[model samples]
Target: MEKNEKYLRAERKVRALKGFYIHLIVFILVNIGLFFIDLIFSHDGMWFYYPLFGWGIGLIAHGISVLGFGRLFDEDWEKKKIEEFMNKD
Candidate 1:
């Protein structure tokens, strides 16, 4: 990869990781706020878990895309394997 291309790829990855972190922070903050509101207003039934579990699934997906199994096919890994195979000649 060319120098600029490498920098661009790294920049994109950093941006994606940063976005995921921000998403997580927002999820936590919003869920905490909703839980409190539910506790004060309802107090009869726990309803926050609906959005909690729903959004939690999305958060998990985002985490997977950012820091989870998606790494198995990342560009750096692919290039390393390609180089390893080529060097066996």
Candidate 2:
């Protein structure tokens, strides 16, 4: 049972990491396309930075959520929280 749980958690972490990578790739590709579009079509002011900045912030948050800042919310922390909740009256 413990091994199965570990496997599941590992799978979840792998999925999250894969998702972050995919998001990163998409952000890069789309931004490159947008840069060229803005460069060719617009001459008044540079507007590509709007979506780039907004999406970049979201990407950073996604990365932080997946990678985590430290061991603050790791599997051990999750197990502790689960036990704490289960033992509550």
**Tens digit of per-residue lDDT, candidate 1, span 40-69:** 999689999999999999999999988988
Worst 10 residues of 2 by lDDT: 68-77
Q: How accurate is candidate 1 locally (lDDT)?
A: 0.94
TM-score top scorer = 2
List lDDT for all candidates, in order: 0.94, 0.92
Please provide, for model 2 over 8-37, each residue's C-alpha lDDT reduced to its tens digit, 9 standing for 90 to 100.
Answer: 988988999999999999999999999999
Query: What TM-score quantifies how close candidate 2 is to the native fold?
Result: 0.83
For model 2, the superposed segments whose C-alpha errors exceed 4 Å read 82-89
Clashing pairs in 1: none
Clashes of each: 0, 0
